[model samples]
Target: MTGTETLERPETADKVEHFDVIIVGAGISGIGSAYHLQEQCPDKSFLVLEKFDSFGGTWHMHKYPGVRSDSDLFTFGYRFKPWMSAPIATADEILKYMGEVIDDNDLAPHIRYSHKIEHAAWSSKDKKWTVDVVRLDTGEKRRFTTNFLWMCQGYYNQEQGYTPEWDGMDKYKGQIVHPQTWPEDLDYKGKKVVLIGSGATAATVVPAMADDTEHLTMVQRSPTYFFPGQNANELADLLRAVEVDPMIIHDIVRRVALFQQQEINRRSVEEPEIVKQELLEGVRAFVGPDFDMDKHLTPKYRPWQQRLAFVPDGDLFKCITDGKVSIETDTIECFTETGLKLSSGKEIEADIIITATGFNLSVLGNIPFEVDGKPVNWPETVTYRGMMFTGVPNLLWVFGYFRASWTLRVDLLGDYVCRLLKHMDEMGVKQVTPTIPDSLSDMKVGNWIQEEDFNPNYLVRSMHVMPKAGNHPDWQHTQDYWREKDEIPALDLDTEALVYS
Candidate 1:
């Protein structure tokens, strides 16, 4: 191990293993990080440790009904890899694609599955990190050391999805389920299904369940915006029809999708009313003018303040329009023996309650971290180029954009990390940190991410525990991908505030 032999990270008698870099979480980010590390620093030996039993983080974990990509596959797929499938692809398809990436790149064996990380401590004297881990199968404790650490654990609590308590939850006789913890043999067929959230999960599940179940009711406290996207990409279709090369088609489609996303965000900011009106018009046309657009469609916040859920061919709206599905936009007073009792004095009968209430936000996978025997305060650490944190040496975390496809930011961070590693090698640096000097310490810093940027309840609830941002370049989180593209790549590593040892 790189650390001193006297200091043992694992309490057990296991000897410590060491590597040049240690990547946490074998999900999308971890896979991408491996790819970049291989390409950028081929000589470096690295290891990937996953807490879960398999790869494909979100796709492997989430099996809720109709779970699919909210963003276009082109944008969601890795930048180097062309998403050749439908614009909006199902979870299985996405998982298969991830499998292809891992297999084609020969990254599978590098991943140690069912290996849960328990603790991390950095040694300043040795410039190495000692990580404690445990294998789920055997209760034996293990230890590993690395010069660099990369956290790919996504920004939400992995253990469970967020579900609020109802007044009479225990009184409910029907089966209660959360999207995150979906059972293998869940039988909603021929049953009345009532979903209790209006986020992406509920929007996705309603139409799928409606097709099979006797009825599906989406009960929401308020409405969220939904936009229509074609199931297939026109360019991909046209290119295939003309017998064009798939590689070229992939590049062109990826570029076009990014441009379109930028344009939509721009228009939302420049003309909020117009975007809102047109979005509502889409719902109106699909559900007919008679549908209660005011109650079931309109949102209190402006467009793009929260991500607009994607529904291909307006399937959800069609379900609502055809009266195959219904919506209740009110608070649930309590759960009854048969269904939910609303505060509006209305009772909705259902056999099953699916709480698609979204995830509880988490930062760095809630892993306990210490540096030189000191507990690192994450909130006080300003974001370094929206990836690394202040006072943390040789560590990087990947958090994607809320307004766009997560892979967009992931791809950027992957490439940036490779570049950073190269720079560090050239400088012969063992450790690097964005340390605040006396002059810049007094400068005001902002929250890591602004609440207004995304008005989602999950984010609002857990943001306080996360890191903060600043108005300055090194500390701010520019959610805009296009702007970040210019700033991140060009960031100078050699700065007075940045310490290299």
Candidate 2:
């Protein structure tokens, strides 16, 4: 509480709290950032403001059957924490791990739960940010002032999921649901279900509900790439048998996983056909030679273009091989009273329809922001390494990697931000802003992320609201973790890209 103070507002009887730093969200990134701040910047007084009642932003919100991580937990889990569970983990498993972090670090006291941030304003003159938040539990409006802002609210809308409009949706009789806001009362037992979309969400749900449903069908406009493998890590098992330290085992396994991922990503660009064939072969090994790989498994896009879902034990294919599930690759013509009518005139009859389309992408948690009395339009601001933006001072948003485990960047960025904060103190600077120099002002700026680099429906749909990125590596949020791992640590704080005052 060295830099923190509480003052009574003269106008309203409300109290205003001030701190050295204010972090938004209490999810994986937020929790991990707190650990770093405590370990690296112990002198700084900070608070975590979470809108939800508890932790686990995505994991807590998603309650769909068989909801789990599309990526493995080894890379997804924090580097400081050793994940002793399976490679793939359920929502509950992730939440439990996050809970352990909170308890271990005593982060609960630093986190203000049920605090929804409505507006954030930065003052250049004061070199501080005034944030207006509402306590969701009591509807109490609270004002907080901070020297720095750390955004970890994630990239997607938690309340409303993306469900495409189809004709006759209102006319349909069955229950329609999205995985984001999964209804606890959704009773799909013995019901004929048609789940839309071919991404990870569809892959997770179809196999989990197949046994309980009368008949389950997966309807996708196009196929998506999936890597089906056994859930266990053989190296971890071997290391554990020899009585190796859990922390050391975690470190070794994490590096190995990252190396393998780098190779795959490199090949996906350098030799996409080879990588594509390897992925297809992984799926073919489970579905047998007779299965229609061309029609039901192969995607039109190359490997690594979109997210590659990891299917544990080939569970989805197992459901397909057992004839418990069916796949239809066609455009949805419209919804019938009973089910959906396809462009090929194939009608899928169902009692329930799951629009596992995806989530709605959010820019800076979709919170209205004002900087020095000017409204900040996200689309107009060019990014600085995807963490900081032009004209924005003393703010860092945790926008993670798309090709690799998101938490990989979280760990990397956590270290970088901590170091940056320490560097600012050494320079005796109260405000630091990223500005495009006169020489680089003419640099070509594009959408926050390049569609050609990585395009998912959720991201493509909200490109208009996302921040802009420059063509240069330093000016954009390079999704490549391999490059950023080395580049970020070596970034010169005194460079022309950042202006410190």
- What TM-score, over all chains together, does every model reach? 0.96, 0.97
Model 2, poorest ten-residue lDDT window?
1-10
lDDT, model 1: 0.85
Q: What lDDT does the true structure give each of the candidates?
A: 0.85, 0.91
Q: Pick the candidate with the highest lDDT.
A: 2
Q: Candidate 1 has what TM-score?
A: 0.96
- Which digits, one per residue and each the tens of the lDDT, describe model 2 over residues 115-141? 998888889999999988888899888
